[model samples]
Target: MVCAVIINAENKRIKLCNEIIGLMYGYIQWNSYDTEAGGIILGRENLGNDNLIFEFITKPMKKDIRTKNRFLRKDSEHIEFYKQLYSKHNGVYAYYGEWHTHPEDIPHYSIIDLTNWRKISKEDPKEMQYHIIVGRKQLRIWEMRKKCFMPKLVCEVKWDEINI
Candidate 1:
């Protein structure tokens, strides 16, 4: 099966594993990006919703972040519709960040994801500066250098168990 992966360019390993794991464990669905433009998107099926908990990003999300419908790229309306869908669902069943997919509830990101996140993290890797993963069991953070990547263990979270 063909699958996509976002990675950290420096270490070429998975980035933001914890968030990914949480998303997967909860259910199957898409989420949103913490950008200024404000839009929600949908990914492959079997996903329900995701919640992100990050503090800051050095580079805040652009007010004009781009959007594309995986199935209806030709029609911009579809994109707009989903964004509204996300917005309407927000605060209840919706989200506020980018949407991604994984092969299973494995909870890992690809090299591309890491690379992208590294750039985002560079702007701000401060506490609460989290990136969401669409699939997997647990969140995995990768520390990399010079565009090479490797897996770094991060704190594991339980979606089912409520924290005190």
Candidate 2:
């Protein structure tokens, strides 16, 4: 299968891994959809291609709801916070995409997932955007280009454990 590695410049991979694992374990142990978490991915593309260098997992809004297999939430607060952080970092960090978790071992995007992704990407058309769906055993990557969503052939580097 073709892939494009979602390169992490520093400790980003580790940090994201830790977060995903923690979320998974928490959900499995607690038996609740409330444990499901998601956040924004921020980074730059200095090495020719884009890479997700940083991540910020945001808390769901008070009015949001979630399910065992889905994270039905909103990102307004997350977007506001990310905007502030991006400016503080002098544009070095911007919204690249999003990340959310699933309860299965092999993750797959639902139709709703794809639709939401398209909406997010369309809101900002200056550049390409990416999204990640973290499953228990694997994480799937997708990219939005020209208003279309496609599975990204993420070239896995050193993140064999996460199956990048």
Candidate 3:
């Protein structure tokens, strides 16, 4: 289990649980032919403090489209998983954002990522959404608000930092 706390510009802490980190690390694109993998992020809000705790994430399903450089989630399983968690937790566990792997040492969001994030932000009921990109050597996290047009880089955690 490897956990990390990311402090945003506003001094708010976004905590990533060990299980969530481990699951994403398992899908990192390590080999040349490895394709992208992705799923939805789910977590609970720290009421009163406004901090976020990311404790769960869905795994890529069989219905997802995958290529060496692209990943398209076409699986309804992801949504089904979310619904189950939401119900099990009585709405405490909510959608945080999306996560995907990038075959690079340090990943940057592509144009498609930006556009998709924007659309999700506009449509999601949550006021804030957080996304993550798992790279070969790092994990980059971004935060997007419903009223914001672009997602802002919140934090980057190197593999070494997690000591995984």
Per-residue CA lDDT of candidate 2, range 19-73, in tens?
A: 4334433333133444555666765444544334544555555655566666766
Tens digit per residue, CA lDDT, model 1, 1-164: 11223343332222223333333334332244311111122322113423222311112123333332111123345345556655665523222233343444445666666666566445433322234443334333333333333434333333333221
lDDT (Cα atoms) of all candidates against the true structure: 0.34, 0.57, 0.89
Cand. 1 TM to true fold: 0.31
Q: Rank the candidates by lDDT, best first.
A: 3, 2, 1
Alpha-carbon shift of residue 23 in model 1 (angstroms): 8.3
Question: Which lDDT value does model 1 have at 129?
Answer: 27
**How much is 112 displaced in model 2, in angstroms?**
0.6
TM-score of each: 0.31, 0.67, 0.94
Tell me the tens digit of each residue's lDDT in model 3 across 1-164.
56655656465778888888889999999999999999999988787887788888999999999999999999999999999989988889888899999999999999999999999999998788889999999999998988888888988988888757
lDDT of 1: 0.34
Weakest 10 consecutive residues, lDDT, candidate 1? Answer: 51-60
Q: Could you give the C-alpha RMSD of every candidate to the true structure, in order shown?
A: 13.8, 6.3, 1.4
| True lDDT of residue 2, candidate 1 | 15
